[model samples]
Target: MRFSRSRRAFLRAGVAGGAFLSLPASIYRTALGADVPPSEKVRLGFIGLGGQGTGNMNAFLKHSHATVAAVCDVDSSHLAKAAGVVEKATKKAPQAEKDFRKLLDTKDVDAVVVSTPDHWHALTTVAACAAGKDVYCEKPLTLVIGEGQAMVAAARKHGRIVQTGSQQRSDARFRQACELARNGALGKVHTVKVGLPGPNFKAPGVPDSTPPAELDYEFWLGPAPARPYNEKRVHYLFRFFWDYSGGQQTNFGAHHLDIAQWGLGMDESGPVSIEATAQFNKEKWFETPEVAKITYTYANGVKILCSLGKGGYPGGTTFEGDKGSIFVDRSKITATPPEILKSTGGDVKLYVSNNHHGNWLDCIKTRKLPICDVAIGHRSATVCHLGNIAVRTGRKIAWDPAKEQIVGDAEAAKMTTKEYRAPWKLA
Candidate 1:
């Protein structure tokens, strides 16, 4: 799918460093402000429409302030199905295209929801920002570390609002739990246990098959190295492959790790050292580990342990402190000593988002940062990416948070950003 000429022109103009082409402030005021609330209608475009994309679209549909103006997907079937869902819900048919760049061309769209796979996140998001559109991209924020930094730069340069879809940050229960830990209500927090779901396990072997016609095979590969499409390498199962994603580490780690960072008051920063050990099935079809343990040591002397386990913990953050330990997940929160739960503190400020999509909508109107801003999301995602690097290299890594790079390891540094496929630079 190619970009339309008009879209390319619009993006080209907005890409002049930090100088965004100004639409009149009154245009924004009349369209976004106003007592009747300027239609309360924010035209939205969706980039990926798989299982996750469909769910995210539905979430946005619930917002009276958002309308699905356009949709795009690499798979035609997924595109058609998602468009139907949006039409049924909104009673308004959105323009559907296989090429995502075309959706970016639509002047009616003020924001884009990128539900694409990990490799595509940075590319789609940077393009959206260059097009002068706000973006809500799924986590982990980047497939690689440098991409995360590039994403932050692009968003800032274009004066665009970008939200990472680490929804747990917007949850009241999760926010309250993080605040409790941060405010010392849980006492001197020493360690945090971040649990994520196990890796994808399949039979020992499956032969790669011909690409599905409904899918744009090359386009889907995007910036990742070229590989033939296999059933195991597409759809939800793609999470198991390193090329497309970092398996459950990034898939689920993005959520749990972000919460762990927030609880430790390290959202804007990250650990300086990391070491990891992972167990992989040498004979299995999966490329990622089935079980692993990673330890991260922050400059402030806090340690975070992230692991994969079954049945015991429900994959959330456990903050252990001198006073007591608090365990919080999606369903509920529990803490030891019980008193910690009842003790309310002044700094336990809740993010107060009834829903994740609504928070982005509100921020778009207010021009404030969303609960999971780009920088915070990038830092949390860096932890997950670094853990994978440690495991893969079998070496302890020294990281410079301010520079956002691995220290003293040229080999490790090379992994920070991948070379894009021809004619598809990260910029």
Candidate 2:
């Protein structure tokens, strides 16, 4: 999509530093300067103030141009705490709400940052888009395959700019690593090993207890099937439950699998076939697999191996090619290929910011898609979800990316989209 003249001028001027002096102010005020006032604050609202959400909120607060205007959480305690934090950080008393819908209703909020759990992502995102608010949603994009497709459609349909929180795409080191692999620094790339931390597993114990009064347990369940609230089943541990999330396959896998696809130049598409085997404890409290190995074979014969294991490649990805291989995680990037370390005067597309939140803010004013657009995020997330589906169904599944469905297995295809609870349907 073509950016409006104001947005184009803002991007050109911001990046090039006064390069577009002749650009019209009308274009700037109408398009690029809509949310960001001349005083330089980008009014922001945050939803889901849990661990990850709080961290994301702080990251956005760190930007000089951003100001927290409102905060929302299902838990009243979290909502209050987040509002306090925002007030302390920005020195502006932000409004707080237990229901995220209220945050969306605020006209003072220019953009919405959704760091809600997996099940809540699609619903919140679709609502935000319908409200005419730009969105910065946390990664794995959607809980199910169809949700991602719906999100992409909603963003386009509403003309809202959306950024998926796959932060590695904005990291220079990761981008450099991907560019190196893409440009054949890793010659004849054969296999990519993407490793994620194992899933959550507790002993067979702990009867369901009463949920804390401060939290709206029913609202927290949202579109997920009704279930008793266990402390472990609600917040961060929601990743372990099949009904809420796809375990680490969607959690950490979202990050590593994305990089693997970037290196393979398969950001817009996915593997043609997926097959997986996993080890799970039926007797244990955990519903998701604790350890598993899933292999995805692409049309070009490139194989991506995702596994739950210890040591060497924790929370990172390893690219193996005919030339050599490289291991990259959040903290470091290393390569066995000596030439990769050596200077190469090759051109590469580098995102301007290393900070993920900053990149989103920049893109909002520029009206350009961020590094992790909905399409790219959805396709990469599909790799993770497909692996989980293959393991669960214990069969090789054929995928048609265009149609976004399993070829013949009706039962398996049914899992692609979930039934949202009453009023929380995806738009």
Candidate 3:
């Protein structure tokens, strides 16, 4: 579980302002417009080979200009599956490793794609950046508010390109919806309605059992409190447990709420106050909320009502303005007073990224910012985490997005940062 010498040194340097930030530029190709030759195509190492990880790996494999140089996972089964898919596509076997730290030590890996569960996101991302590798990490960006900020700080300090996998940001309809709202075509957006799915915990009464031999349970639980292995506690089911995820709140909310933040032009800021009410599953099966309704009001008086499974409307983000309203989800977009749809969204165009994965690759080569940059992703995730904090504490929390702190509630503010379990720290 040892990190590379460079990664160890970087970790020892800590998050102090000037340590990693001052590293000589000789190690990185910081220039823009440099073409990566065929032989020098971006070298990528992938960690966390689950469903989303495999999907992202497939997308990267489709990129002719990139190489899937390595793969890592705590689950032997998942690692074998990913290796099979990668080998079939590239006609070359990817170097495999069980510990992500070992993968970081590989000199050939120029960038890493982190698709680990929420708890592992910040540490993997920070370690990768410190080791001189760029990162494309999956969303909810971090499990807690403090982790999000640490992730932003890490990427900034190392001058690395970290793209959070909120792929909806790269979709066409979502982009156009945000553009319309931003350009005043929406005529002063006053409200944003977001919807999330309900909790679906299938293992409510299941008993804990020994973990499968194919899985490294200890490593998977890194940074999370120790718990007995249960079939329902790993993989997709991990979303239901607060130790690893924020349930549907951070699950689907990360997507829809992110769009709400984007359309409202609040990517750099957040709501002033939050009001929420949540219900837990009767079975006490999961730690996250069962059903919740959270409302966030920005400083400008814009109010957002997020309904989980109770919006009465479909599951998606809707931007409501004085003049018109636009409802858009992953599948489609609709505009009321439909003629407003024809209006030119104005000259202020957001980044055009038809493909999120391709967008990351292009930015990696050019050293340009991708559409959903780390800071932007962190801001979006902050909104989600704050909503959860409000739900869990059952209090209307006031926030200072600039300071990234809860305004008055001492107990609630502490939830912003969690105590890591042990040796797994948020470096």
Candidate 4:
């Protein structure tokens, strides 16, 4: 079944910035009743208060050590909605700002949660790190490979805690699955299968139009190329476009593939080579592939076959070894031999993190790296990016995990980093 989308019409459909604050992390705190101490609290500022951002805010609200200090969003509506959530929970209104830089500059903010679109993730994270604030950035940690590198650099240089929001690392099922694969419970693992969901772009195409009053369209397009505002192109739907995100390849791939990297014990490194093929929507409804088969080869000869779409492998990560296989997703974990699932997981015990947000908060106090550190997120995202590069260029890409480069392919290498749209550069 070949899915084809017309490129000519879509190609004709469209045309189309901030500073760092240098300061020490804030120790400022407000009254948290008699139970919590002022010195033990982590004042959090939030940037990009959309669906994911709001979700993250609610999670942080559950912790007594975390206090919502401020919220920022390009959309005024989002800012208001987020503020309402914070106010209802804390019984106090958080400082709201249209610009993220102002949120970072606030003396009350010791850390920030960056749930912006993929293009804005790197910039927000690097800037927050430079401002002496810790960061919890959403998955697919960067827009490009180079951006991830820059984020890692800034985090290390500032001595800030930067956690990548690959929350699966905290899930018990995923932890057991990775432990089995790493501890030889799965015998010498040779193949790992990762499945991602198809794109969710169901809306019909709409013509480009004027920006809404509530949205700062220009500011929202920070670091991205110029383009007219289209209702379907902003907010949650931006994942379908190449200029903003790499579709489901990077969206869901970031989560599942990160688990694959963990199971393979390659958090600091990535596959040695990648090859992919994909099909796009026949109506040209969106730019990303509707279905794809990406093959990644690791240095140790472990093969990862990642399939996307309807007829692909079932949604989850499967590790196939000589003795048995372990399959895991958000729902449950299963092993081929049944008894493999009951194994004590040998001597290798992966990091135990029951709550993703809690781990970051604990690390913030201890000054230790969280479960999904910036570097791990970068390596996992590199795998997703390499798969996209292969699919986009229609060629096999040789990668160097140590040097973090695409070997022998100049064209593909260029896709690793994108040109910023004036003023907004990676920190």
* lDDT (CA) per prediction: 0.81, 0.79, 0.85, 0.86
Would you estimate the TM-scores of all the predictions? Answer: 0.91, 0.89, 0.91, 0.92
Query: Candidate 1: lDDT of 254?
Result: 94
Question: Which window of 10 residues has the lowest lDDT sum in candidate 3?
Answer: 11-20
lDDT of 4 at 71: 96
* Model 3 C-alpha lDDT per residue in residues 22-127, reported as the tens digit of each score: 3234434443244545555778999999999999999998887688999999999999999999899888999999999999999889899999999999999999
What would the per-residue lDDT of candidate 2 be over residues 87-152, giving only the tens digit for each residue?
A: 888677899888888888987887899998899999999899888778999988888998888887
State the displacement of the C-alpha of residue 387, model 3, in Å, after optimal TM-score superposition. Answer: 0.7
**How does candidate 3 fare on TM-score?**
0.91
Q: Write the per-residue lDDT of candidate 1 for residues 241-352, one digit (tens) a residue.
A: 8888898889889999989988877765689999999888687688888888889999989899898745334588999999898999999999898778887766545455
Runs in model 2 lying further than 4 Å from the true structure: 1-39, 200-205, 310-314, 343-352
Q: Which sections of candidate 3 miss by over 4 Å?
A: 1-37, 310-312, 345-347
Ten residues in sequence with the least summed lDDT for candidate 4: 10-19
Better of 2 and 3 by TM-score: 3
Candidate 4 lDDT tens digits, 71-92: 9999999999999989998899
Better of 3 and 4 by lDDT: 4
- Residue 46 of candidate 4: its Cα lDDT? 93
